[model samples]
Target chain A: MNEREFLKQYDKTAFDQPIFSVDNVVFTVANGGLEVLLVQRAEHPFKGHWGLPGGFVDLQKDLTLDDTALRKIREKAGVEPDYIEQLETLGSSQRDPRDWSITTVFTALISKQRCVPTDENVSSANWFPVTTLSELQLAFDHLEIIERALKRLKNRATYSLVPCALLGETFTLAELQHVHELILGKKLEAKAFRRRVENSEQFEETGGMTSGRGRPAAYYRLRPGAMGFEFVRSV
Target chain B: MNEREFLKQYDKTAFDQPIFSVDNVVFTVANGGLEVLLVQRAEHPFKGHWGLPGGFVDLQKDLTLDDTALRKIREKAGVEPDYIEQLETLGSSQRDPRDWSITTVFTALISKQRCVPTDENVSSANWFPVTTLSELQLAFDHLEIIERALKRLKNRATYSLVPCALLGETFTLAELQHVHELILGKKLEAKAFRRRVENSEQFEETGGMTSGRGRPAAYYRLRPGAMGFEFVRSV
Candidate 1:
């Protein structure tokens, strides 16, 4: 048969297919630590347990896996993330109780200031400190997924300005350094951090200043249309 | 219902599911350029068209996406790769002719010396220079998938010992530099490159010497049990 005829005769339902879903690990810097947004599942398998915001891909609505991730983030988190990236895809016959399943996990960074506390679809939504993940029960392999994403985010913070997505539109150098420190789980020398940021040329003065600090520090914002820059050395 | 009862009643066949598959872009340094392995499809969908080695994830045989990728590589290329990494997952309604399909792409690096050329499962298999990709007609979105994999491999080579996977068990420093140059598409200064490699401490002297070419060069092998190390500065 020709190509067109072959497609017409193809029957996808002849074989067993894995249940495919997209999950988002939305992170923000809050309460002096990195926090991940999670929603209490409203349906079976893991209902009432906290899980990453996600669901089955709507074949009619999603053009790509990314579209599924983005749509889920909006529907469950009620906010637009400042940055998002595909973390990894995990699959197995054991991860889900329903059947063989596969999920593509996405990592998103959003400023906590932009998020609404909860969405109507989920039983409840909350931002929980990543440090406390061990004490809580989560659905599927979500805890493992979040830990992996956290490791990636930490490594990324060392060479790129990715953690800036956790902050507001404008901030002082001290605030920026704090976000980096939180993600890196360590302190950075103030002088060295300033030099690295200046060399990267990824930010611009916002002509604003912090009001409550000991010394009024100037505010800066990421340059218009400027993407994250990779630094030669860790800050 | 309880978890066990819920799983027993859940029917995966009730809902329409997207076809899930894994594709691998296996790369190696050969003929003084970067090359990717492609296999001619023996099945009807894109029969006889050159494509990245890939196929449907067998529910009975594959436990994870990586397993599917590795199985396809072995079946289509007849070689064990030195390194393999997941690139990204791509899904859409229009890309596949049979159905809405989702594919997780993987990038692998292998030494050309080990490959057996053609495998029994494919019509034909060969390594094609990445620079000539535009001239060849590829099946599905395989061309776009290969390009994306190529870009990721190049970026990885900049700050990690990833490109070494494209060499035999032992290779001279000069040979390693040549492989990096082919991937980066630019010449690196000899002195700077050597310094970077030495500082990374990722290789050990194999106590061998090259037999051909202008001066005999000392050979090196990746340190035993050593994973790829990220450099503080790009080489």
Candidate 2:
């Protein structure tokens, strides 16, 4: 049926009424370490509760999903990002206190030193060590959300030097491995880990900055004169 | 100010709508096969579209988020899931063709072959070879949703032989490998893959049904003796 015929038959009474919204899982790298960005609640439900950065979706907002998440993170925390990814969606009923809402989770990474709690609603926005974030009373089912996001990054790290997004612009392989260990929750054999990373060749020797303290370490950046080392298909 | 005073000041006109709901991402292994179930669309605006099984969240129903997703999948496709997991939410404004919708992507796996398509609306419901699933034109952003689901399954497979849910009460090592290969989307070096599989320690020999063209593949079942895994942490 055409529009006119469809409307004539249409009940125009009621149909599916789902509350759509977005929630963010911003993960940033700073201080030679990996961490996640979290905001302290300022209102009820879980007032004084700690959670990932998120809010209701405003249909009127002129922004894409990714844009909205990044904007909210920056506005709420006063930090800009160098890397961001759409993690997953959370839509369990009772995930919220007052309504049945679905949340889209996104992840963002930036220099840890760059974030400062700027918004009034955020009583606190701090970077918690990735090794320890799992032990807190996470507001909502956010603990699970964080779990999935962390796992994705860990898998990504095996084929790509993604933890670099959680690292300084220039750093050592040892420093990078520390991030893999922390995120994967296991100690990777150093020799094998180094071999896999170097063989991929997504990094170029900067021949610039040296590792801080004691022995000097090689500096590298997004590889030049090299392809992206191919996105490895899952195996 | 308690309920009385708050109610007097509250703008009832600004807030008037029933709550929406979220589904889940479920994964399981049976007969040593890794497959995802889907439903044929029933309503208009992509009516008859092949998609994941889900529906509106009926908050008035005495069900939680988990229950809501379970009901939708079972009702829509007659799938009695052994395991159902919440993968993520897809809340894009344009996701639904006919109405404003916020969908929760839930991934599940069933062990029995009898759970095949039975619903009136579903033209067919069957498991896809996870390796070739990405090539199909899934409705909405479900294509991306499945990708995330498969990624979750692959990572989980390394530590937890969750794929056992796709296999039968007894199965061979080759069946297990096939399931993993299908989900991971690449052929595995049998020797290397077997080493990893045996190392996870979640499988047990059945001393039961074993069959093969050449060598008899050993039958194994879930080490029901093992305890459930804890929530994995994220990025």
Candidate 3:
């Protein structure tokens, strides 16, 4: 059948409408472990409980899901994430209370920078250790979202240089390894880790030194074009 | 503000309602390259042009988006892909002709299998080599979706066992390497490839062999519970 003939029989208004929202699972390495940014909801529908920083995607101002996430972060926390990627999409019949909605989940990795007090919608914003996340009462399916992001983060740290977002612009090799260990929950042999990093072609020595109360170490930064490099690794 | 005060000021009805849809990129390796399953649209919007097999979410019957993708694939093609993963979510407000819709894209990898004749709603179903996909006029933003999925497949073949889905249930090491090369578009050193595969711990030797004209080669299958293994390789 020709496309024009098919179009003549098609009806566009017959499809059901569903709402779409964006949620961000922002992670940062702080306090010697992996931490997640959570906000205390001040409104109904699981009010007062903790939830990931997110809101309804504003199509009026946002161009993509990535823009929605960045806008939400900027509006609620007054800061931007270091790295953001689409994690997953959750669309169930009853996942939302307000409507039959589809939420596109995004994972935003950032350094240990606190969310500035910018909005009254959230009573409090804090970073909690992911290991003890079970103790807190979270709103909606946020706990599941965080778990999925955590799994992705752990797996991605081995291949992509995304985890570098959890470190400052310039960091020592030890600091980089520490961020990796916190996410993967395992210590890496220093020699092997260094060798892998050197072979990855993702990092470049910055010719700077770490400022700390110890023997100063050389610093390095991720090469500009290597952010999307997929280095194979046996994580 | 306390939680109660915040709830009093919050308004849920102010959020804009957006429609949701699911799109599937069913991929297979055929004709010596990667191929994507495309169905001719028998309805309007892009009547006659080819598009990814998908439909509006059937929240009335399906429980989740994953279920929606599976149900659509079953209804349209009469076959289930071997490995399916959430790829990305596209929500650009005016992406749809009927309404503001957000479509979650899924990538379903399968071995070279033919799509059975099924739904009459689709004018036709065919597989096209991804390399020449640009020549075909695709409906909606399907061309962009396929490109995203193709990039993901190429990168994923280096780390995860997903590329194995493009091969038969059991395959020889040489065949497995061929699948990887086809997807990655590069040749791998045989010795290095074997060493990396053995180190992955994701595959095990099966007590069977492939009967070919040259010589019988031992068969290997993905180790139990290793389909989700994240093997590291420097792709």
Candidate 4:
């Protein structure tokens, strides 16, 4: 094309831009503990290493980048984030060794019981306690992802009914405390925590007793319209 | 650079990864209300338009993506995110008209008193009331940026004390509610919200009271050691 035509024919809409990708940190609560789900990679580069289950975006695929990531989770892990949100973007000049890859890290809170190991790209899958994950060699920048995910979850526990996301329909408050303590990495003031949680109006007593033989704790779960963001301005 | 050399010596960081950029949403509580800080772009594409304060990342120039972003916030808008964090990344096939730019959005809450607009690239900087922002025209995906920033801040409100980032070093609980009402888009039930907030121990009730108020609201801010990302867990 001539310079005149080229100057006037710049199609911004059709301009060639770089590609985008997504990664996920899928977490679940199992055996009254907090754990992160990881898979053993079968491909080269980081082959034979365990990592967070995620893959590239098929440029030819027919979906948005965010949707593609969630679909990949379902495609590989057989479990989707019951609740998913974008965490951060990891886009250093050389974050990946292949092509220019821009990754939007998404955090997925899913049910631990429903997960099954079933992906061709993966050798095996399992959940590891957050505290005990250092022993497992992780691929890419996954260790950093776990640390950030844990931080976000821990911060939310004190003020929100966050642990409920990892639980089934019915659970005792004691079970909730166990999850919180694990995430918080310490025991909490039982009476103080109980009073505060019971006062939020975010949870209900469920009017049912615990299943165990010990202290019969009150069963509770999230109340309707209660599982979302609420910005509390500090003065 | 020969094919044999390329095969024999693998450069681990050789792929084309989309560069990550961060757009900051810095808000402050001023003039009896909540307001967002914005900058006028001086460069091409969105030149002279009001946009969220942000810029491209010189990844090698900074250690971490968030660090690069925080630097850009001051460079572009002359402001800092007191409540700085990685909110989300916007990376569609064509979000940027220039190149493949996958931007991670960061929202910082600070007392407006701490910041002032002073940069040549930023033509005019000002805080627009959060309530009336919808009526103004914001460049790029800024409208969407504000929406997401508000949502995340609001979502974290009911459960976290991070919002204290928006307040002055010393202020009353009623002052906090004003910031909340501005962001939440509705007046909150004072009695319940107050009770819930006080229980979190996010703030200390300094022996002070509102000068001109009914029943002298109690003063509070993010509790010193009581606040941290250590407990924040992600998916």
Number of the top-ranking candidate, with TM-score as the measure: 1
- CAPRI verdict (incorrect, acceptable, medium, high) for model 1: medium
Model 4 chain B is weakest, by summed lDDT over 10 consecutive residues, at B226-235
| Model 2 C-alpha lDDT per residue in residues A155-232, reported as the tens digit of each score | 776666566666666667777778777666777888887677677767777887574678877876766544224334
RMSD of 4: 7.6
Residue ranges of candidate 3 with Cα displaced over 4 Å: A1-14, A119-123, A188-213, A218-235, B1-14, B97-99, B167-177, B186-226, B229-235
Ranking by lDDT: 1, 3, 4, 2
Candidates sorted by TM-score, best first? 1, 3, 2, 4
TM-score of chain A of each: 0.95, 0.78, 0.87, 0.80
Residue lDDT tens for model 1, A48-67: 89999988788899888788
- Per DockQ, the best of the predicted structures is 1
Instruction: Please write out the lDDT profile of model 4 over residues A1-235, one tens digit for every residue.
Output: 5434553664433422233467778878877677887878766556778888777655455235576678878876776666777777776545555433456777777767667656654347767888788898888778987898788877777566666677776777777777777777889777777766666667776898876677777788777777763323100
Q: How large is the i-RMS for each model, in angstroms? A: 1.4, 4.9, 5.1, 6.8
True contacts kept of each: 0.71, 0.26, 0.51, 0.22
Global lDDT scores for all candidate models: 0.88, 0.64, 0.80, 0.69
Q: Compare the candidates by lDDT and give the number of the best one.
A: 1
Tens-digit lDDT string for candidate 4 (B121-168): 555776788878788777778888898888888876655666767777
Where model 4 places Cα greater than 4 Å from the true spot, the runs are A1-21, A28-35, A42-47, A78-83, A88-103, A109-119, A124-132, A150-235, B1-19, B43-48, B97-101, B154-235
* Cα deviation of A93, candidate 3, in Å: 2.6
DockQ of 1: 0.71
Better of 2 and 3 by DockQ: 3
After superposition, the stretches of candidate 1 with alpha carbons farther than 4 Å from their true spots are A117-119, B117-119, B212-214
